[model samples]
Target chain A: MASLYLIGIGPGSMDNLTGLAVKKLNESSVIIGYKYYINLIRPILKNKEIIESEITNEVDRAERAVLEVLNGKTVSLVSSGDSGIYGMAGLALEIISKKNIDIDVHVIPGISALNSAAALLGSPIMNDFCSISLSTNLTPWNIIEKRIMNAAEADFVIIFYNPKSMRRQNGIVNAMEIIKRYRNESTPVGIVKNAYRDGQEVILTDIKSMDYNTIDMFSTVIIGNSQTYLYKDFMITPRGYSKKYEY
Target chain B: MASLYLIGIGPGSMDNLTGLAVKKLNESSVIIGYKYYINLIRPILKNKEIIESEITNEVDRAERAVLEVLNGKTVSLVSSGDSGIYGMAGLALEIISKKNIDIDVHVIPGISALNSAAALLGSPIMNDFCSISLSTNLTPWNIIEKRIMNAAEADFVIIFYNPKSMRRQNGIVNAMEIIKRYRNESTPVGIVKNAYRDGQEVILTDIKSMDYNTIDMFSTVIIGNSQTYLYKDFMITPRGYSKKYEY
Candidate 1:
């Protein structure tokens, strides 16, 4: 009866690792993750066998992680942002469900990329907004396009994750094009580079002025719908109170 | 010059508190928070003078938190949800901007009611969603109505904070009416009771079946817009996928 702990260690900071999460990490006999995440928590691993895999091999990583846990090792798998968001929890559980394994799995939620991004950008997420990943790894392009269109049409404040990567990166451009397909071009867009990490940079731009090429694997982009506004050095996606409050 | 640390202590779980948040909390000498939240973290506080205040006395709490810092006590004003999100940071800064206070005010981020509610109900917030508080105490209904209309029209998943209290409870029905004004009556809804607490209960319903009377101070109600669907065991809001993926 091996148990697997799928933990979401809040965005990058070491202190973000909850005391419970750190305890769970210390309890694990083997730890599996992408190389960077493994290295991030290496100091506290405490005699746990570490399996550091590449980012692209998430499915492979899960398969190996499951096999190890099934072999009676207390296993802990990690992801940077909350595990459920873009992490491997869904896929892992899906695999477990398929295998009919009765193993117990625990998911520890971490601070997601957007939450950190939103924090760095000074609360653009304070209003009503939605988050979408521009990655088509498991999700398709046409659906992503429609989601973007629907979100923009819904006048949602948008937070985009997985904006771009090395090989397949034009999703941001297509996403913006779909957003502009329904929303006004004058909307404000805020970008967080390496959010919650050292050398974190924040840039505010307009919807039409977005430079797709400048955004890479480390950036999170937030686009405000038509009703979103800025005041006193904060970007606000007003949920319609500006006119009513003025009086 | 005295410095104020605006730390973002995550949701109720100690694991949710980040390393940065701990450093800030420990560095402060005086802590001010609503009674409920103060009770949660009282055991962890060390060398700090704690000020437990009720929710209604926010301005007074903020004033005292700032005043103590101004009086040379390293002060920390804590908010349960993200400090800046519909909480004290904005108002405190506004008051500080109006006065000549000599202390530095730091706004620490805490997990907002949104993520805490979402975690209880599996993946209702998966793709894109926005939150709007229907409370008229600080915001006018006209703005609330427009935001609801915009969010409903946008088909973004919606989470309502402070849905109903003793006096302003009418806002929930008004919000439902406004949402129904722009959306279908069959959209799925989820109400989380005492989210993250011991007696946590999640009720999955729809716009047609929602009743505002069941909600009170301890509950967090999440209403999914047009695209949100109700599964038997889970409240599934489509990120526009799930059809393509073989389940």
Candidate 2:
């Protein structure tokens, strides 16, 4: 159909790629993505026109992918996690809409970092949860702070993405301070670096004992709700089944 | 090493299953899940001991799967979506912890209904988001209301699961009223039923114009944030990319 397939490659592991994602990648004539993400799925990107760009060139990559679809080429635009969540799907769709281009677009869902990280650290996000990206590259720090505060106040299990970068280091620290106002210092936090990928590291710590040095741009940090607790090496959040059932 | 694999089958579509999930399912001697979810993946259940339970028997299914693993059988306990989120992973892990079972447990992530629904609805959850289950069977209604109000007040994109059932129907209506206090009545809301599966339905409507009749337990409803907008047949939430870069 000469469509633009916005595919999420899942985490870094090829084994985590959904069967639908693999089929779409096979059907795509060209692949477009950030250079790091492109490398993650390079094993399956054979005989395709691979378009790699810098991490900051999201708009350029999105525009190029849409233009390729306009040129009657089946294009696959890849994102590291779920394409629709903090990924390229919105940008590409926005570009197509603003340009008033008529084209077929398929948004393929994937196992996002939230799902991947949660599984690795037992089940810390078993109940109501909210995800806030700490990257101020696009969103204002104030808005991010408000989200952290409100999510904490609501007692929602919170996940922090892009917690720390080389240039911006205090986002997580500031965020934890705001969360502490609503939660206790003993709240369990699960941190996964390079989830399901090479050099993958999983750590279970509390709010007071979390080591910021272990976190980076690639890490996903999960702060549990009031009910969350650490048992052995796994962080567990009961989905309130105990209140209803005898489990 | 008879490990218990808690696997997410990814919203009733075999094509959405991850490679690792397939591998684990093939490796297992027994498969346990709800009857509906087990039927969804019947093609892959060949030569395996199948254990299907009613929808309300999650703890039973989890306990049975754990018992099978304890009896030296590799068991795959399947969930329709990501197991860690409103699924069987937490329950199984909790049971194991409480019983002090020394068994290998591997949790495999999958494309959850949230991820699948967001993709079908076209990027409605690109920004910060929270998911709240509307069912009061396990959680108190007051707690659910508090989450809805706080998520809305925080301006996080909200995803509603278990929106409606035969016995309880006013959850979505009451939730909308609370959200209306914080958001405009015209806020974009996307609804997807049986996402990526047979009888799949995707509707793009606004807060004031939503059709509650189309929603059921199988439906996932997404209410957009302030920045979300409707264009063509798709609902989109900009990742605030326009504020930093021109598109």
Candidate 3:
């Protein structure tokens, strides 16, 4: 039974990898992923053939993984976070569909960056939340701006992925400006960089105090909704629990 | 050391549980959770004290877990999915904050219902997405409606948690109507019931064809964005990859 396993290794930490993900990795003889992601799970890569690709080469990597499965191999394509969310699963499935390949594709989910960052920041996304990526390499900035404005207006806890890059520094600044129109300047914000991995940094700030320069592609930025508050260095969006219950 | 571990057990399956969550559960002297969620991991509950509570008693549950920690007993509070997302993490943190308790709270992230449902539905949330719980238990219907409309207007892949319950049945219908205003009637929708658990059910339908009667609190419904399409039973929302690359 040849198959392709799209596994989320979970925010660059082997401890965050699920038992099922580890089992699939052990079952497969070959594992493919981005170079840094491969390094994150190197402890489990013993005696396994590894294919590491560079960033921005997603299509090539997904195509190669699909081709390996087509060639009667049990292949694993690993991603840093949940494979289904902004990871390799979608690209691999699309390639399989377009090429008319007959094979099993199992998406084994893991702790996404969103989940890991939220945990590190102390439950900043316990309510209705939306995740928007600020990378304009694929998505246009106009659409991203609209999402920021809409998310703020709806009063949803908002998570920003790829908030800043070396070349695209102004996206976060522009997005913040749009969101500030709807949210208060004192709303709590959490910035988590390299969550669950080495040099992990967690910063609790507010809309008016967050330094955009500290954010990069690796940072996950969560802006609290109107009711969100900061208590004792922890950022929390209440999930409206306080509105109805006494704790 | 006395500490409280807020752990997400990853949607009712031991196989989905991360190694860190299991280690924390092992380190704790007392494990607390809702009855159903506790039963999901009963296999590992051997020789461990378990406190099972009824539904709608979240404040009581969180308080007990916090008190156990304050009494110098290591405690683990488990949730079905990621604790930071509509789970026990926020409630426990708030209790700790308001009481001014000096305790270490470690949030172990897990595969949330959104992640598990998206994986079962085959990358339906690969693009920008928002999760809104239709449970009016704590959140008002009007607020939920506004979130749904804004999510639709922003063209985001939308995930509905607690889509329906025994007492409330009309939220799903009203939400679908609002979403249809911005999306096409033929937009792909994926419904996953009891994901990764026993007797799991997965259905792929369109906005117009989805049976609202079949949904309940145990179900997670994913409505795709404008660019989403179904490929041989798999619902996928492209991450603007095809617009820039060829496979």
Q: Can you write out model 3's per-residue Cα lDDT over B40-132, one digit (the tens) per residue?
A: 999988788899999878999999999898899999999999999999999998888877888988899989999999999889988899999
Q: Over the stretch A1-247, how does candidate 1's per-residue lDDT look in tens digits?
A: 6788777676767765666578778888888999988777777877779899998777787788889988898888888877656676555665565566667676666677766776665556655566778877656777666667666665657888889988777788878877777777778888888766676777877887877777988888999767555444455554333344321
How many clashes (backbone N, Cα, C below 3 Å) per candidate? 11, 0, 0
Candidate 2 lDDT over residue span A37-88, tens digit each: 9999999989999999999899999999988998999999999999998989
Question: Candidate 1 residues B1-247, lDDT tens each?
Answer: 6566555555566656766667778888888888887776776798688889887786787677778877877877777657656666654554454464556555555556666666556556665566677777755677667667766665667788888888876878888888787777887788877755567777888889987777887677888756555544446555433344443
Candidate 2: where is the Cα deviation over 4 Å? none
TM-score of 2: 0.99
Q: For all candidates, state DockQ relative to the true structure.
A: 0.27, 0.88, 0.86
Per-model C-alpha RMSD: 4.3, 0.8, 0.9
What interface RMSD does every candidate have? 4.5, 0.8, 0.8
Question: Which wins on DockQ, candidate 1 or candidate 3?
Answer: 3
What ranges in model 1 sit over 4 Å off? A66-72, A96-101, A140-156, A168-170, A174-188, A205-213, A224-247, B63-73, B96-106, B140-155, B170-189, B203-214, B223-247
Using lDDT as the measure, the top candidate is 2
Candidate 2 lDDT over residue span B138-204, tens digit each:
8999999999988998899999999999889999999999999999999999999999889999999
Alpha carbon deviation, residue A43, candidate 1 (Å): 1.5
Model 1 chain B weakest 10-residue run by lDDT: B238-247
